[model samples]
Target: MSALDSWHPDSKDLANLAKERLSQKEAQYILDHCKECRECADKLFETIRSQPIVGERRLVKKQNWMRAATLTFFLAAAILATHWFLEDNSRSGQFAIEPKSLPDLSETIYAEEPSTWFEDAFTHAMVSPDGSKMLHVDSLGVSLVDLSSGEDLRAELLLDFDQVMAATFDGNGRIARFANRRRDMGWFLESGENLRSTAIPLDAVPVWAPGNRDVVWIRPPGNRIVLGEPPDDRWHNIGDRVLGLAWDPTGAAAYGLAMSENGSASVLRVRPLGGEVEIIREGLDASALPNGLAVAPDGQSLFISLATEDEPDADARHETRVNRDLDIYELEIKSGALRLISNIEGDDFWPWVAGDYLYWTHNEYDASVMLIPLGNPGAKPLFDVVGERDGRFATQLPRWNPSGELLAYTVGSWRLADWGLNLDTEVVAIGSDGDRGPPAALVTGYHADYTPSWSPDGRWLAYRSRRSPRPVPYYAGPDVTDDIFLRRADDPDAEEIRLTDFGWEVGDPNWSTDGSRLLFDSWDRVPGVSKPWVATIDPEHGDLLDVVPLKLPDEISGSVSGVYSPVSDDVLFIERLNPETQRLWVMLAAGEVEKVIDFTSYTRGGAAWTPDGESIVYSALVGEKMQLFLVPRVGGEPQQLTAEPVNVLHAQISPDGLWIAATRLSQKKEIRRLPLR
Candidate 1:
């Protein structure tokens, strides 16, 4: 056995011996070594004859079949798996940042013919109540549209970097709001005003009531429900940011959904406006009710849409298809009774209730809107215009008008999805079943776009735009700039206007409380060097040229990620102490730098301020892996949110601030959420 184990074909001198015809010198050397080494000599000869020769009938039959069998098995396996092994190994190879190719078109030409360089990757959209205006926000800026004609109204700068937050329309469809930093909210009302705003003793994300009367907001720790006031202070918190939150039609009650450590569904807490006696519902998995409450006209019961991940798939390749259906539930506020209304599948998310209809989106490989009648037996498909409503390579974020008669959604694309494809995005109108038609292409770009918010009246829409980076060589590499834009929803005769030209890159545009102003930030150029700069724009003129650079410390540019306050319009960004040690910093809407709080010392970048603007959630590198960390903006220790070894990048705050959605790396890239405590 030892001799057989020791035998290796490479060790054989048989080739030399055959070539030299058993030369005396070589033969002598082999014999000498063999005499001293019993294993090599015993196994060498036997292993050689195992080839099953038919010619040269020399009567020498050597024997080590064990070694030959073992070697042959391994070789066969290697050959059989060669293609698979090569493909697998090839995917594992290091990914490098290659230089980007810059488009040769002039910036003006690109401005006039937006899609000349960008294909429609617009992902999310919002339409005004009157259906005249619409908005789209993306990696670029805020875009307003005139729905009557496919014309750009205004393109305003929203963020200086990538936006990871969801945009929602106010109940009246008159204002559009998005989460900025903690305690901050960006809102745009009917007046087309742009502002970075917040209320005193700020709340979490500001969610509007179904009637658009009061904004349902969150207050941390002791999650309290406050009524919406002027400067906007109706804040509430549901403990964890990952919890599900929903508002009743009357804006009277707020529901919180959670899953316990045991994987059992739990109704963490429920708060009714004005009267505060928290209600708890237990015995459930995770609920799909992020802003899920839509009160019945009688006010006797609450209708909510609930969803839960069924179970892990048997095959890992099918993981993307894991969370499929939504279990629509009806819950009674006074009796604490719960009943399943219907079992609907196809990735139902962010359901909006309008009159007798429950409107929600179903992502079946492709995401589209569907309306189900509460009084009827079935649901109706509003449109199959995903590619036309969205873009060729699209991601969906839809918002409906107060009446639910009209709907608007945002669309954007991934880098790989549009790698070689040409596309465009449109804010479509679906009056009823089979009424879907080609959407009004509001924004155009060579790269990607998203984030659509509609006014309460459905007459106006606000959106953001981002041009893909065009590489210009620098230091043996290349530089890229992703720009921001905005347009009007109603003025289809108008053209989109470029917002920020600083070139540091921009994203995530939000409207102020009254919609008279828009607030967003700009990221400075340089990989480990960036800073947030706030700007003001004239929504009607689509003038982004009035940007006034926000003041910051010299170190602000050392390393930063762009962001803004969801409530107050304050510009929020992350500053780093080198590539690690990220700090959450905020600037007032007036271009004044305020506080700089050291959040996490993680050896990584990328931080998102929670909807409330009290704490910032960021990504941290743990060991050789990256995870999510939540740090207070007031300066405190950081809390690790995720324990996975996978890398989490570009984390986004949900509209209600209960969930931290992020891009997770698996076999391919996937979006996941982490609950905040």
Candidate 2:
């Protein structure tokens, strides 16, 4: 073999390169040759392509890439840039190009290890049965992407991508099934080299029987399970209150988890045609039950990532924050035997049973997708590196640049436990490109900074800060209130221009289309009351012109936060209908009203407008995690994005409309394995 052909970095080198443990001396030699020889670039690109890495692992930009050796981090940094070249992406997106350099990787480089398939926030990735393809679903829609080529083989777009939920690959891997929140099922199938789809219009999503169209579904409200074929009216009741569902590889029987009214949970194995339910395991702890399930290839075992049975202790007299501890469990189908597969402190969830291994999301200080052997699965080692959240610092409300290169978020210190009383909070930003890092400090000081919004020109950023000159009286006692302020994005020492006056307790700010104004709401602590306000600013000078309250139609009631569109004159805002429900409404510049559908979420930072102004990206609860979703500006179905166990507090589209810079609330989870022997 030729020396140039054989001397290439493998996956291990790439991982080590990402962690900056790879030898930089050798890495420099390989890349210097790659720059001059097209053949060498091709060989290195092939190795980079074949690496078994997925999920978002952003490279840390360092001076070493330009000064010293070409490290293996270039292998990962080259991943999307190569795809961008083949696809000819417009302008600049995240990882469009790497400066070619190496080691000294930081925690920010691989902080969020998520799907590498979709560039934006991808919620779910369902690999095919043959493991040759993945059903890529995100806020945009669903597409069948080739695993090797990174090409979209098939796509079935249905408006907002958030509406596309609960997607899975069928037994043959040619057909895919998906459902929307409180909507019907839509089928994406491959027929004679063509992609086609049909709306099932059923109330609940149906889990397909192994090799056929027959499906088993759990009805809502009472959580009743039913056996039926789509497009037909007749259905047989299988069971009720199913928590999770799965089918055997042989298609002989189906498995489900049932939780009773008494808070007891059980696992049931039901015969498909006859609807005979056999209780495989009963009286499992109902608390922290698993949200997903998978059956082994042999059809003799089932796996689940279950949370600890103990409930989180409630705080004495403040906002309640539940810290749920999760682990993995396995059950033998024949013997009705149950075994704990994982005993880690962090969360190990979303188990997918493959041939001889079980893969899951392992999260601790950082979240990663990992797998372990089914037999003799030794204890999976915990992530030794501590994250920013592992310390007193925890991030919330992340906003990113349109290029996906920079992320701006709030970092605050939590004493005892975060009850929103931390006064050490500040707005900080990080970069994905080799930009060293974001500006030293966007907004910092004794005053707490929150809700940062970027300007259209990327020159100025607006945020809400608790920097009132005098103490404002909160409900309980006197406390520093919030006001709108603007700071230059590129300058750390620039004087911030205060937008709102001293008295008003302002909300988060959103810049106008031309960067001439900001839209926000006042009155943060008052419940059931939201008043819209606008602050005018000069795009060229970054000076606050004036601040005024906006008048709304009389019919629009409830606590409404004004979220102006980035690309249009329309005004988009969210109104809290109740403690559980929120209504998204859009008002045209011509005084016409359009009401979007209502969604439920307790953890929210208000809705944000997309770059195109056609859809608004927002977050709502999917299971226990807060994920990003999209609703059309004109009013239609909302598409959901992001499916990790982590919560996305905020997300926004970039200037070029090329990326969705999501601000994920700082969280960590990892996948691990437990022995079944």
Candidate 3:
């Protein structure tokens, strides 16, 4: 008080006061005098501002109590903030403050419910022509995301409809068009504006004309292309066998691919509004059916996605078609010269051209958004939406903002028709004879349960259940920690017992011949990388017995898929010599390993032991489909079992060895979109 009352405090002293370094008495003395002295008050104010605290400066007068109170409040707040800053910086001496910048474009903007699974069809997303908003739709509903406000403005619209077939936005993004489950087409304008609804054609594909002048869609019954607004849209019957459609960027013309009357092949045709129809190209390959079409910005060329058509064989078990070999081609409008654009290994479709880049979606193990520079032959993927092989999960539909600064796509895995990584599997048992009563479920629940194994006595069923939510490297359906579970074989409703809890993934549990112990594969902290070890568990009490490592040659490091021999004390498993080669091996309980079968030419799944244990049944990719094959335990020419077009993921012999139980799968996927930085 003595120093503050007689002389003005220095700048350092004022800074310390704002930082709460001065005693309470000294702080109060300085505050009291600053209200009467404008020069000293301004100095204290500048000192507080320079101290890097968040607050505003206030003026005070000797008699103004409110102004004095405001000043006092700001000083206290600034001091508290300064204390926290200093404390944090003291712990980390290298702390630094960086100026804020624009949001990182590399980061992704995902949906509110960012799951790993999706519905059967493609979930579409589009950006407003003005780039101010984005529209996303799926089985769940529709969402209109406002880019500027970072808010989902049209969440209420999603609740009003059960399913939205498609959605498009006007040039300004203030108006939106939607086709819903009731075959009704509607427009939603800005808040306080009236919403318009009317009946439209069902299962129609909606497209917005350039500049949002009018809406065009492919109507059914005659497969005619319609133009104009709902209830008054006019049909343009250019051809009867229309396969695909595209519109010019200026909205002056439309293009379509139609099959010839003879049905031998397809031809490309173009028609200007109210103008005569003209054939652009003819005699296209019939086996390579056109699935998607898009016109370049200059309107001089068109891009098309062609999928190899499937032709069923007379046997009803085989279909001749290219597996994931869809290709993209470009056609010049004037010259009518068609050239291939993408000749990759996967199925490419849904083309969109913007600026100097051509974007499309490719589906293989999972779907990916890909792009290539215009006039450049090489193409690369930006990211994987869904997958298991390489840390990719399900994602679809990618659209670019008009400004081209942001991109949006959807993320979720699409389940296969019968079985896939997306479905929660159950265990069912049927009679060995072809004729029997209705099959019954042996193990069923909300959780994913599969890979069922019957104990030697057939009294207990050992299966894997994904109960814990842990993020796995691939297969992004649900966070799964696969654990072994046991249930009564005879009682479907009986309470199940948990057999193992090692905090690691465990699967393929097989019982010993006597039903006393269980053998399974687990990826624990082993010495070598990419190798899984075999572990034994007591079937009676679920206790870990021991971990047996496969001592293989130096070139052969990885081993997995272990199953106990029903006839001997040997463990049969798959050993990998490299990424592309794997062989079946039998490891004796007495510590010796022998190669049983070579799987170098084809990819293989889990192998099953027959009732007599003389042979093994496994699934392999022979040609275009995954089929079942049988081979003797000692190894020889493999015998093909099932030649169906479907993939046989796993096969097991019935208890009586009369019929084989197998898990069959067929897969399909659609694209989606989300915000990208």
lDDT per residue for candidate 1 within 1-677, as digits (tens), equals: 55434543244374443222344555445544543454544444443445332343233323534333333332233222232333353322121101110011001100111110122222224445454544644335456656456577543323421332444557665544443544454443333444434352333555666666656555443344445655645344433333445565566665555433222444443343344436555554333223344444445554444443233111211111133244445566556676543343223333334333333332223333322221123443123334323332333444343344444544432222112112234555554442555665654444344545443344445555444444111101123334555566667666666666656545445455445444445554554344444456554554664655556655366334455555676656666564245666676666566555653333333566665777777666666455667767666667776665344444545444434434342211111111101
TM-score of 2: 0.41
- Give the runs in model 1 whose Cα sits over 4 Å from its true position: 1-444, 450-482, 489-494, 502-528, 539-545, 588-605, 667-677
Model 3: per-residue Cα lDDT over 54-144, one tens digit each: 3433233445544445435646433333344334543211211111101111112222322112232333344454455556554455667
Tens digits of per-residue lDDT for model 2 on 396-476?
455655344555655542211112333322333332221223223456543356647778677887888765343221111
Q: Which ten contiguous residues of candidate 2 have the minimum total lDDT?
A: 101-110
RMSD values for the candidates in order, in angstroms, are: 29.9, 18.3, 26.3
- As for lDDT, the candidate ahead, 1 or 2, is 2
Query: In candidate 1, how many clashes are counted?
Result: 153
Each candidate's number of clashing pairs is 153, 25, 19
Candidate 2, residue 78: the lDDT equals 43
Give the TM-score (vs. native) of candidate 3: 0.38
